[model samples]
Target chain A: MVKTHIVKFVGTSNFKMFSNHMATIVRLAAQQQQQQKRGMATLKAISIRLKSVKNIQKITQSMKMVSAAKYNRAERDLKQARPLGVGTKEFYEQAEIQAPPEDEKKLVIAITSDRGLCGAVHTGVSRNIRDALLADPKERENTKIICVGEKSRAILSRLFANNILFVASEVGRKPPTFNDAAKVANEILNSGYSFGSGRIVYNRFKSVVSYAVDQLPLFDKNAVVSAPKLSVYDSLDENVIQSYLEFSLASLLFYSMKEGACSEQSSRMTAMDNASKNAGEMIDKLTLTFNRTRQAVITRELIEIISGAAALD
Target chain B: MSAWRQAGLNYINYSQIAARVVRQALKADLRSEALKRDEVNVKFTQWKDGKPASKYIVFILFYLVVL
Candidate 1:
């Protein structure tokens, strides 16, 4: 009878253990189901984001190709135009000629890309312009801004609506012609807008990863003379100087446009590259979660089978 | 001029050198701060409706934990 009682107590304890194991299995199964559903949802979302990123990458890649083609041509023109522009400035210095004091209004021409996928290209140029303008207290009252791209125009208008004089659109995509730049320049010059000082703010492309914000002086030829001792016109004829100045202004405009294009292409490429990499990473993470949830479900099933076998024994 | 002369030379005080280095470091810090002023003013406009790109990773981590 004592032995029988001991066996009964042992059986009751085993039964309780079995019930606890079953409850744990139920709870685990429910948790696994929830986890699996969440993992699937995450995977689906990641796939969708990946597709969108791919489309963006293709668009940015095309833009880079187009910009590259335009940049090459612009760079050639700039190379030929830079020396002439320099020579023209030297002539003005040697001649000791001042642009008529009537043209005393300062003009700032800020160039940026029309479309944005380019990382920080537009922002950097805009920031440089803002900083330069704010640096000089006198510039605030007399300064007029001429924006080249639509993006730049929009930003400048929002920030300084009262100061923007004009905006040139759709010029960034194509090889900017001297005629187009001259037209913009002529309008500013003719509008009773004194060219007291003019500056062209744009990027100078050094490589795929680096660019510089270069401020080219548009007015006051003497500003170009960094040293006081150097002779301004020790090397050129008066006629050459006149021709060179015209060509140089045209070239400066062209170079800025080219450099801006190059910077835009590089920036877009980098942005897209990052986007694609991020998409890949997301897909990987989702895949990992999906696998883990799937394994947990299997583990719960294994636990149920083992518990059932033990009960049969 | 080699070993014998080198051994007889007076020991140099490093405090003067340390002071010069400290002054140079301070000057560099000032210059960098001036340059940083131009960079810091440019504010990045954030997307109003959606989560920021940086938050996406954190959201994924939370999702994984729940799963």
Candidate 2:
């Protein structure tokens, strides 16, 4: 009876070992199947990424082309508008119209645009104002900001929310006009901010690839009247002065808007061009990776089939 | 009195009228190009509760375009 019990225990131990071995085999088979699925999933992911990258490349390329055309038109319009700016500025310089130092109230007209993705065009203008405001705390207290475009407003509103008077939108959608300039100047005139001095800060279009922040000096009626050169001209009456002031303001605004628009378009062109180039590089790398993975998947399957056939034989 | 003030028009309105006349006075090809700048399309929105208000208030400004 003792011999029979010992044999029964040994038989049960052998059966347990066989079952454990079978379980390990099944686990191995499941892991291999999972690995194959993972390989296919990776291939699908790479394909999807490659497709999306291609689409992005196409969009950037189109944007670059559109900006190029707009830049050309802006450059042409800028040429005609350049003389107008020079003439207006020359009058101010000759008249020696300057704001008195004692005048504390100030206005800053920041020129940018509604659109973005132009790469630092709007930020450059906003940064200039921020620097000025930071340099003089007193100026910050006395100054009123008029944002000509939505982009500059968005940037300055974070800290100087109260300083902003208003934001002008629906601009930069098309070529700026004298009428548009007049409308903006009209609003400024009527806003009753009554600033003693002002400056129009804008991005001056230097070339297709470069731009510089520039400021055009603004003067109130008092400064214009107090100018020493005002004595040189005879019979310059109040109405004439008013008309001239209004016209000059409009002219300057028009010129600055044109310059800002040109700079915006050129910068957008450069930004889009760079984006397209980067997308192209990514596409090349992704295509190489995608092809390599696809080839590897095929090779892996072929190897599996061949090895399986060998095992069968 | 200036014709603009006499007509009860501000400088902006006067300028628009003057610009239209100038555009009309331009030579054929230049006139077409210059007139294109006369078009003004503006939209104004009032925000409430951190969102743009649902109703749009359209204010149509009249411009006297000289033929």
Candidate 3:
């Protein structure tokens, strides 16, 4: 009789790196086992692989739970923030404020988060900016990028480093505040780039498992003041307009950050859930292979013992 | 001049200070809930490598600790 015991894996700070390597190894092992090559050594290897996969499954399960908790808060917050964003945008639309078409200079603020392991949340935002950059050479030359998180900066910096004005890191580590948005908005206002117009590229939350990269238009003080319908509003002093621009920018940033956070949490929950499921399937396959190999070894030994006895007879 | 600017705060700090005041002035029932939104403990670091060695390691540690 063969007894199998699970070997405990001592996790380190570099566990993510270790788990990534284990995932690839498991894939290769699964492929090798598919060829039906069975032996005692292979049985031992399968047991070890099974242990690691089980450990990873446990981690993924816990990660899924954590993400679920975060998702609940994020979704709630997003509900409140959505109306604020919509109202701001509606004002801009009703006023007919748009960037002057001939103004070539543009700023692109890419809103993402520092953390990853969420399914393509950061990548979606970066790809939107990348597509815009690639679409027009002239626009690319005039465009300046302000990345809101480290993940997008890491990706976009590879090819468009020159285009990036500055990057804001440490985002999405905690729930964002209005104060945080104000800080980011103030940075943009003071960044000395003096861009004619801009658009914020962000991932809009659609559903629990899905998100779409969306763009929100940004206008400078000049564009806002130059709108044809501005004359309809009375008592609009310079101070009020300036204050509104600043406040509106912060509110828009706050709203978009909330949406991105909600999207990220939901996507992470889904990603971890899928990872746990895949690990379960892998463990099942490895267990099947282990049992078959153990039986094969036992039968081979029995055949040798019986043949030796027959020779003696 | 605003109280924040009088204390020599920059525009960024000034705006944040003002926001805090507004959150503080919410009604008793609403203030507690609104105050929750004021807490941000995010830490920032500059990345020198592709993997963001220092900050990424800390993030992973925190993630594991939470689990």
Candidate 4:
């Protein structure tokens, strides 16, 4: 009876041990499976992010190409207009010398781009204009602003909305023709408030990557008011001068628009380049995790097989 | 002779079981370390720039328009 009891006790203990060992194996397997799931989820998220980054890169690249093309055309146009603009300025200066004095109000036409993407282009232009306006001791009441581009309107409207006499939005997407610019110029000239001078603020595209905030005086105050002899024009001839004035303004608007577009593209390109580099690093990490998980699975299997074979023997 | 052979088989089984458990533990540790390394690599990759891409886009646009 004692011998039977000892045999039964040992059998029960052995069975319990086997059950515990199986339980441990099951638990380890479950844990590994969970880890794999988590790793896979992480990898999926990374891949999604990478795809989005790639899309952004493509868009930025296209924008860069478009901007480059626009910049080339704009550069050509600017070159063509340079000689004409200089000649006109010289003629105006000579005419102003002989013109009579009159009440003149200063008009500032500030040009900015509609879209935001180019780094520092719009902000720089706005800051330059603001500084110029503030530095002039001339009373704020005498200063009038003509904003070109939607972004310029939006920004300037906040501070000088009331002072904004006119906004030209059409110039943002395409280069404003001479006719469009002349309309703005004529409006300023006819606004009943006599202005002494006109100034244009715009980004002068120096290169594909470089731009400058250029402030140019369109008309001199003293010359326009102090000239002794004024060229008197009948209504019909005055209409012709109006057209020419508009043409000049359009040329300036066109230049600003093209330069802004170029700057936007270059900035986007740099941003996308950084994103691509980051995606590459993420892929490397995910690949490592995948490899390690696979190796761990194999090691676990090998251990289980070796233990089972020994138990069979 | 039969009793000795049985005892030897029991001992070998126990040793194999112990080795299997140790190997499983080692595998677990290796897997955990690999996961950690992967996480670190992902983090390093994600934050290439200090600022988010969206913010950078806004900054660039503002620069182009205002500058």
Candidate 5:
């Protein structure tokens, strides 16, 4: 019986890591005439695995709750600031500004979160920028990257190492404030990269479950100044126009950051909720398997006892 | 009266102003001493007595009760 147990256990390589204990018990019971030991061992294994799955469910459920709380405030913040971003962009359209000249440097600011596990959020932004660059190899060479989150930086830095201007870490650790966006905008303006135009690649929060990656133009200093409709505005000093450009850039970044933050929280909540549900379903399946196996062992033991009594008679 | 309002007319207003000021001051304490002091360095710890030497309030209460 012991030899049979070892052989049976060896064959149970296909059993799940969590199910290994159950498989061990099943193997031990393969040739045993009595049933108490095997039943206890197998039952113990199933219970242990069930407990772990239940713990996982608890963790996922709590994480979902935390993100759901954050989602509400982030949604409100994005809604409030979205209009200002629209207004800033409209000013550029009214000024009849065009895209930067082919010769000038292009900048892409990829906004992402420092933390991940929020349902493939950063990949969309990274993919969009990569695709855009691949589509235009000419612009790719001339382009520089400013990644707002470590996640995006890790992804893009590998491919566009030389083109990276700088990386801002510890972003979106909390709900983004305008000050946070302002600091990043200030860094870009001070870097003196002399980029002709800038583009922001961010996740647009469409609803609770869906988001889309999109890009918005951060009009260049030269483009804004050279607009044909510039003459319509009262005469302004070069320094003033430069400051206005900086303010607009900061506000646009703030709006995008808020929207992206909201999307992150909502997506995380949904992902965690789904994980908890899947864990529950797995637990249910395992419980069913455990019951069926236990019942079979019990019935087989009963039949063996009855047959042995008949043989004795 | 104008000077009084500048200083926050009564105790309630004055306390409110103080609370706001304290909050702002605390908010700017970005590199908090408490966080740095409490940071875990588990990898290189000496493992003295197989237990932590102190855990803030636990240390104080132990002295009060045990001694």
Candidate 6:
């Protein structure tokens, strides 16, 4: 009975402590609210902020709509470009073309866009490549990078320094064209820097909600020429093989660009949509706060008038 | 979401796969003509990199006529 009484007394003291803490919190909150009642300046400031927030919401909502529209056309272009890219990819797979040893020279083409605000679409690919290269000693040796978008170029240039061989921009905006890819590949080919094996690094759009940093491999001539089953191809000459490499490079780049475009557009659409939603929520919260402040001001004014009248009486 | 986290082993480059299968249906060779735009399907669009000045349009028109 004595022990039970002791436990009860301790419990009550704990409860009292908690209640006291809550009361102090309430008092602090009341003090903060009273401070916020500083007459006109706070009210004016809130109104200005409210107006700006509303305007920002409007702009983000419109940007979301524009991206949604562009996303549809980009999806269509991606669909159209796919069939054009399939054959060359198949040839490499079926031929079981050898890939040069990882230690050998490698080329990675990063596909991204110039603009941003699409939730790290460009940085995801570039950073992934950078980290991967840093992790692998073999990969770090003679791994040249070609950046296909301005954002990726800017980022990877800072990270990779001399490793960036070519930078291609003005891509991923329009429905990607085969002509553009061909031109870029030709330009790189003419630039005279070569690689053992090449890969196109890009954002692969799996669905409206998902994307992946993907690599489409392009093996070099030595690797392709020495494929264990290359005899099955029955091709004639070295020139055919070289042209085949060029053409496949172009086709794959074209298709990768289209896919990147689709991913970028859809990503932008979703990112903008989320931004607009967040802005809307912020506006709602700000409006409620503004109304509360206004009410406090009015009540304070009424109280002042009544007290002044009482004094006169 | 990150792409690497979402990637599955079954994943393939769908565009390249589709391109391979559509050649016979389109009645065209996939190699030389893969990236070529046929004359009939070609289009020309006039676009300026920011806002085009009035002189730029006139110059473009003159260049088009010359072509």
Please give the ranking of all candidate structures by TM-score, highest first, separated by commas. Answer: 3, 2, 6, 5, 1, 4
Model 1 chain A TM-score equals: 0.67
Q: Tens digit of lDDT per residue, candidate 3, span A67-180?
A: 999999999989988987898898788888979887878999888988878877888899989988999999888998888888998899887877877778889888787777
lDDT of 6 by residue, A1-313 (tens): 2123223422422223233443454455446547776554366655665675567568767878888898888887788788766777888888898786753888888988777768768878898889978898777767878778788877876667567766776765566666667666766676677788878899888888788888898888888888887877875467568656767888898888888888988888877776666657656776787788789989989999999999999
lDDT of 1 by residue, A81-113 (tens): 556445645654555554445555788888785
Residue A60 shift from truth in candidate 3, angstroms: 0.7
Q: Model 6 shows how many backbone clashes?
A: 5
Off by over 4 Å in 2: A1-40, A232-235, B1-3, B6-12, B22-34, B42-67
Alpha carbon deviation, residue A75, candidate 1 (Å): 4.8
Q: Report the number of the highest-DockQ candidate.
A: 2
Higher-lDDT candidate of 2 and 3: 3
Which model scores highest in lDDT? Answer: 3
Q: What local lDDT does model 4 show for residue A100?
A: 24
The runs of at least 3 residues in candidate 1 whose Cα sits more than 4 Å from the true structure, single-residue gaps closed, are: A1-104, A220-248, A297-313, B1-67
Query: Which pairs clash in the backbone of model 3?
Result: none
- Report chain A TM-scores, every model: 0.67, 0.85, 0.89, 0.63, 0.83, 0.85
Measured by TM-score, the strongest candidate is 3
Ranking by lDDT: 3, 2, 5, 6, 1, 4
Better of 1 and 6 by TM-score: 6
The DockQ-derived docking category for candidate 1 is incorrect
Off by over 4 Å in 3: A1-20, A23-38, A232-234, B1-15, B22-36, B40-67
- lDDT of model 5 at position A4: 42
- For candidate 4, report its TM-score: 0.53
